[model samples]
Target: MGDPTAEANRGLAVGPFAHDGVWLRCALHCHTTQSDGMLSPAMLRRYYSMGHFDVLAITDHDQLTPAPDAHSEDDDLLLLPGTEISLRSPESGGPLHVLGLGVNAMPRVPERATLLETAAAVQAEGGLAFVAHPWWTGLRSDELGDLAGVTGIEVYNAGCEVEQGRGDSAQYWDTLLSQGLPMLAIATDDHHYPGFDAFQGWTMVRAATRTPEAVLAALAAGHAYSSNGPDIHGIWIEADRIRVASSPAVAISLLGAPPRGVRVNAGPHGLKQPGDVPRGADGRRNGAYPGNLLTEATFPLLTGSPYLRVEVLDAHGRKAWSNPIWLPARG
Candidate 1:
């Protein structure tokens, strides 16, 4: 197997688990009354604050929502100036939503800009652009494969999931990855309504400080993970294997190219420890093991696998996803 540490040092690193930084819970995509959201900007801030989010970006549609001029000392929430611009995809002619996070101001583009034009505009304004909910937008993997200057895609969107069954885009992500695009993925609430769609998903960013600039920088560097409930403590890649430590989960999977992944499920035989086969409360092996009993796992790196990412699924079906760790080709 190849040495993953060496590959990471060569600038192919994804997770920042070995780095020094604080993990900030971030809501990267959402709206307020400024767009078609239920809450106003002030109320949205308070909602996320009460939910214990450390950073937030109010990506109102077609317009930038300015951050507050001043915040109270007790208010530690870092608000980033952002917007969600709608662009036309030449392949499909449908609207493509691109999130512009941390832009100083909205950029100038044609009324019906292409995805490339939109991404360039967002980047020109010093913002990071992300393709939001490609599956929900009915975008084919081929259409998104050649994208440039875009940071990533939303692998899971709570709003789309709740409203329709088209939110999980991991398949599209894998297709893109198989084609050799080093793309990142995020899970978001894309929240428009409270109670029903808020706090369903978020990104945990590793930043040196609790400021907007720091958070944006961390995101641009791919120092983050997306989750709905499970927490990934760490992911380490060694010479011959990859190890993952996470909160108690029902399953931990290392996903890679087709036919090149590993899944560890906490079944009736829990870790198969000497006497750890779980039994039902009635004292029978009826496969009633506690769902959140598997906390850590390791898997050998598959030879010829181009890239690998980790997914941790908890008892409640919530999942946390790591960005891909691209592997170096063997000489």
Candidate 2:
């Protein structure tokens, strides 16, 4: 087998997520009474456990509220320490939040903080840091390029969606990929209220075991995908070909910056006009544009490209996204 680290860095881990280990449904970001959330740690545990989440990280604002020890004593659930940090960003003229997951202890944050400072502190404490909802934070995509030491970002923040409808940050991930950044993206509930924002988003990680270390290691290794509802069962990548298997998706897209992306659609619609896509109860287009439902797709990538990632949009307007796989630039 090739080097696992190298394959992970390329964002194309083959068969590992399916055959190498089991898939762990994880709520990697959420909140509780340790900060502004309505639920206490114990209640949060009960909620997610009932939701069928195998792993949880209670990322309260500016504070680390580890799950109750009793919660982890059972074999069904694993809890990891986490917190969210806020820092001022001049670009957005607002605060940017970063989620520090798998933390051993809370980072030392100043009364006033910057993104780089806070991220460094978190990493120094042996945590994995992810920029939390750049769109929700009023940040432009370029603003994130200045920050370092972050593993990835919250591509979809469910709380931001329910509250202000500013959640889906898929464009930001594409922007970073176009800039040649090897960043990963995840979907999260970022739940504050108990039932309102719960279970709307989650990360699906592939690990050898259900322990915190394995989950965190999978996250750090990009052996994961994020979704609102759709599930990606497998991704197969070769030198110039790619194949994806997922829940009944309306469209499977291989996306990069403009001029670098393509998609395939399934159903009797036969590629409807962009305007013909049906609207959902939310008034947004259901599934992806020009398609109705699909469960698998394959695409070809020319050699010596920049980067590409996979996105699957289900009939219910939910989506699953894989971390981007970088390619060598054309000579």
Candidate 3:
């Protein structure tokens, strides 16, 4: 059997990994003095640029922060127009914060628009809308499962993590995926305070170029991964197995439908035999062993499994998450 094309694969949506592109480190959600953040727009730009971010979106509350008229010749950072809006959610009868990345025009919607309505407006303005910190917002998985137009969810928010213990939302992402929602996930600092909250989480995008259009197109097509730490170099979905390469990690996991997932761990006492580990094209074990670090792994794809996504956990417990690779349904 051969690898399936995306169209033949039906519900499958693999991000930029399937193609050749430059990996862009992106900070998609953040604030500046225009809103509640401490830094002004100019200062915020300098801060992220100095942090080595390739792209940034200053998503201040309820208003669009224009990108700088021109970046210095020495600065290669790409800035995207963005904003954060609070819409009323019928499900929770409270605020639902949505990040509008690449939205140049302010959306026209009612003061009390629903998530569906807000998402439509954001999309209409040529932006991608993502739900921010569902866990911190006290949103239920069922509430998000059927929402149309929303791009994805914030799987990790550093600000939320620091203020409260509700930073991770992988559980919510898994629930949506299991229900057949091909939702993408992103990690962000949700920057408010500089020294305390910045650089904690970010999304890595694979784009052919650093232009705003290319990055936005990549994100809209689900060609990105989210991480607080750790880096996913590549993910190859094959006919019967999924292969992954990443920065050195202590654990690599393939998460899917109930009871269909698998995990590989590296420890001081590694696999009983080095021969038991998969080999790479270089004819060496895919990852290091015995010293408690890993760089690559391969896992069998269970037949009839709904979807498969990867998670890489470093020694410090930080994680990187890949978007789901949906498999075609069989009779």
What Cα-based lDDT does every candidate model obtain? 0.79, 0.77, 0.79
| Candidate order (TM-score) | 3, 1, 2
Which of the two candidates, 2 or 3, achieves a greater TM-score against the reference? 3
Put down candidate 1 lDDT per residue, 70-185, tens digits, no spaces: 24566788888889898766688676888999998997767767777888899999998888988888887666434788888888899988999777888888888887887888
Kindly list the per-residue Cα lDDT of model 3 for residues 50-161, writing each as its tens digit.
Answer: 8999999999999988776434667778999999998765687666799988886988767778778888999999999899998898887766534789889899999999
Show the colliding residue pairs in model 1.
Answer: none
lDDT of 2 by residue, 1-331 (tens): 1222233433354534534777888998888888898988888888888888989999988887766755544547789899988777757668788899988899998776766778788888889989998888888776654567879999999999999998899887777767777788889999988779999999988888878999988998888889999887666675566666677777778776656666766665334543332221001123654444665566676344477788888878888898877666744
Instruction: Estimate TM-scores for all models.
Output: 0.88, 0.85, 0.89
- Model 3: runs farther than 4 Å from truth? 1-14, 69-72, 268-272, 276-290
Model 2 local distance difference test score:
0.77
Which candidate has the highest TM-score of all? 3
Each model's backbone clash number: 0, 1, 1
